[model samples]
Target: MIISKPNINKSRINICRENSQSLEDIQNQSSSSQNQTPIIDLTKAPELNYKYGRTSEIATLKQWILENHTRLITIYGLSGIGKTALTLKLISEITTQFDYIIYRSLDNLPKLITVKNELKQFLCQSLSKPLPEILDYFKSSRCLVIMDDLENIFQFGNFAGQYLTEYKDYSKFFQQIANSYHQSCVILISWEKPADIETLQSENQHTKTLHLQGLGEDAKAIFQEKDLKDDEKWEELITLYQGHPGWLNIITLAIKELFNGQVYQCLIDEDEVFLGDIEALLENHLERLSELEYHVINWLAR
Candidate 1:
């Protein structure tokens, strides 16, 4: 018996070759042709009861990330000055542009290496991937990583931006994110600029820093929200609280309860704003002051 090879056209031969591939390989090829579903993890984000008045800051942040593809950014401000609120607002606006959005808070003081490993696992499906591989993955997909309360990694009572020794890896991680070729960006929200970040970062390198200030005229919204009376004294009340949303919220509560929502009367009746929980917030800031700062406070007290 003579076995003869069947005639096969080039197109049929190609189809036969494609059919020889394993199911897993075929599945991978099909999946690679399709865009991955975006992974958004914002569980750590804080819920805001009041609408933020950070219009300009939010606009600038959007421009930096979406328009410029800025890789590293720092948003520094006094505690309770609306840094977190502004960041959350910005994230909400730009979430559609990224393939993955992750928000992490350093407030609990997690190790930087631990954070890096977790981020790696989240991005690459395995924490064992090398840094270069992870960065390549970032290049292929847009990721937005937000680290809030970065000051938690710093040592207090020293110069500004001094990272705790154990957390130094964070600086290196940020440097890589800034200098390497990646399509992702990281936003750090802190009380002061991190020391290494301030040293190596430059605006031309897709690295930007924003120093957030009081809301100024925007503070009026807070007053309006609380329905406090005395529209004429709104500026005075805002100035007294230094336009700090946290402080203004505290004062509004006081005026609502003690003066029947009469803001002007509250101001006239009390020479000084009753701090309530604001005192604790101020004390936390005071504890981070340097020796000369303490001396100035002592001299002023005298």
Candidate 2:
């Protein structure tokens, strides 16, 4: 499992209160008026420590949301490539622009109806009459809805991005979000892009996809933070692991424990790369591959 250090920062929600009003007066206001404050629900989100890089990626996402007003965005990449961290950082930068910010994980494979109903209820909490359709709420208010871990809804041992039979309705929901007019944005985070997303991108200007890649030199910070020595050898180690943050973190622990934080010792044998506990991380990604994909990988290995 990928583990992130606890984030010391907390999301601050600003409430607009009259400057002339006393604190007591604001507190005494009706509960309905108080509920007008934007709702932020990130309970399901993982705590993110200091993120290493992706300055350009964050800027592109911000442009899509703020300038282009894209309705649907799919951010996909291999696990540990910082998809979630990048998104959380993006949200932090642009939180105040939306009236509601909500996050959900599809790891448990919740049905589309259930997800829609919950979001609608949360978005419509301040209204005396809740909107009949989730899209109605999107039209009426600005929302940033982030759904993570969407790979869970996809079929295992199949072509990447094929949704399971039970979860197929999600494709329709996504299409609606992409095609229909809305003032809101829905971001899908997955290890594999949904098949419909590809089709949507071709036809809709508001729909977009971002394929995240390795951090390159920006990942050197991970080693620096771990206080590993032999700075000259850090680039070789990072390249061997493709600058994957999660894998690099696991390797750092192994280096510190077994090599006494000496980067030179770890790099003594250039012919062999030491995986240590990173084997488990690789297995997690490998186990999700289709038969054809597995065969292709096996052929490449030989």
Candidate 3:
């Protein structure tokens, strides 16, 4: 079982750059746009960046990205459903097939305005090119790129960057990035699949979309391997939480400690799941949904 690092300082960030910055790159940005883009300030939430118990989602997306001609593949699901973790796992797993894999989490990028710069920085590292020339040079090469947790560039709140206006949309830049080369893959992981992404699907065979469902039998086994109290109790809990790996991992970890590794007694106590990580994830997507939709998700999960 892998235990991820806890988050340090998170801000309620609204980025003013033309590109989205990764969590690690938070300090590097000049202008913060907290006043713009309504998504709940994820910068202030805890870091929910662990990858756990979503092997099938990772494998399926991996297969489509590697086998299909499409350069950009989007993985969509509800909030806290492990979209980012799936993409992170794929980047680590698929590196062998490509030159190298580069990942950029759209965790804090509230709008499409910041995609170009974020992606450009990511592309340079993944493709091993100069940052200034990444997009132009990507006309030929093989690389796997992932942008996680992206929302609409068109209709959602205030615009943030010049890239939105310059590139028409992030998808077009990504479309070219993925389609320009013969053997390259670009993946987008989002809470909800945007219509622009759906419409931009390749007419012949260039783009693919993978919708992430909750954990299955294999995933359940993985959950058991992690920190949860017992097979039976954890199984019941998953029924309530929809088998989201990240949330379940934290739940299991908390349960394991509460039982002091006794497993059975933790089951007896029937403690509610932990809220820090799940709350952070919810906060990340809170701006994109209504207040009722937001409350019901985490409230019912308990």
Candidate 4:
């Protein structure tokens, strides 16, 4: 469970002020002319404390959004790879560009109707209206909607992108958004791609995908944060963990206490590498693996 980092620094506060309006203040406004002001709801988004090693990815995303104004994009990655952090940083910098900005997490297992209704109410558009009528708001306004943790609705113990029957409506909605003309963009962040998304996305269309990978050298900062020693062996440790930020942070505590901050000594002492509640991070994947997949992994382990 990722918690939003509080006590944001002065620079971050200044960023909000620089926009002249903030997502936190959106609820205070009851004015009918909200279309003119940038309205945002980022209450569910985790607060960003630090970001590292995603400069190239951020640049590519900005180019796609600013240069082409792509309508739909998906960001997928393993847990704790900083997908949410990246998106939060991206929006904080560019929040002023859109008239409406909405961020919601699918981790709570929200229903498709509930999501549609929430958008309708926020935009002050009519309920019980046709889908076209509701979507017209996007056609007329520059809205940016981000749905995070989309894999929550997908079935467990299955291949990537298999949605549960109840939540499958989300795929259809996304497909419609990609195919139809709209001035807005909707981004989905998940551990796996949705089955329907691949069918709709094309080179000619304003649809694309970004798959997040572990941080490379920037992972050294996690050790620096923990005050781990043996700077010479940091890369070796990082390579062992595939530069996964969460794994590095967790394993560092054990190394510092058990091996006196000597990363090389820790590596020599423990062959298995990462420890302490690490399996929790892979719970979703574990639950979904097929019998054949389990057999393959078990056979390879021997």
Among all candidates shown, the one with the greatest TM-score? 2
Name the lDDT value of residue 62 in candidate 2: 95
Better of 1 and 2 by lDDT: 2
lDDT of each: 0.74, 0.81, 0.53, 0.73
| lDDT tens digits by residue: candidate 4, 249-297 | 7788878888888887877756475566667876656666667776777
TM per candidate comes to 0.81, 0.87, 0.59, 0.82
* Model 3 lDDT per residue over 165-217, tens place: 43355656665654565566667766677566655674536777888877754
Better of 3 and 4 by TM-score: 4
Better of 2 and 3 by TM-score: 2
lDDT of 3 at 109: 46
Candidate 2 residue-wise lDDT, 1-302, digit = tens: 33221221232232232222221222233122423344566667776553588999999999999999999999999888889988877876676577777889998889999999889877886589988998999999989999999999998888899999999999999999999998999999999999888888999999999998888999899989889999999998888889888788888999999999998998899788899877887788788889999999999988
Please say which candidate is ahead in lDDT: 1 or 4. Answer: 1
Runs with alpha carbons beyond 4 Å of true place in candidate 2: 1-37
Instruction: Judging by lDDT, tell me the better candidate of 1 and 3.
Output: 1
Better of 1 and 3 by TM-score: 1
Lowest summed lDDT window (length 10), candidate 4: 10-19
Error of 1 at 258 (Å): 1.7
Write the residue-wise lDDT of candidate 1 on 1-302 in tens digits.
12121222210001111122221232233234344344555556665544757788888999899889999999998898888878766755655566667778998999876787777766764235555555776787788889999999898887788889898888877888888888999999999888887666653468889999888888998878889898999998888888888888888888898889998787785656667788999889889878988788889967
Using TM-score as the yardstick, the better of models 1 and 4 is 4
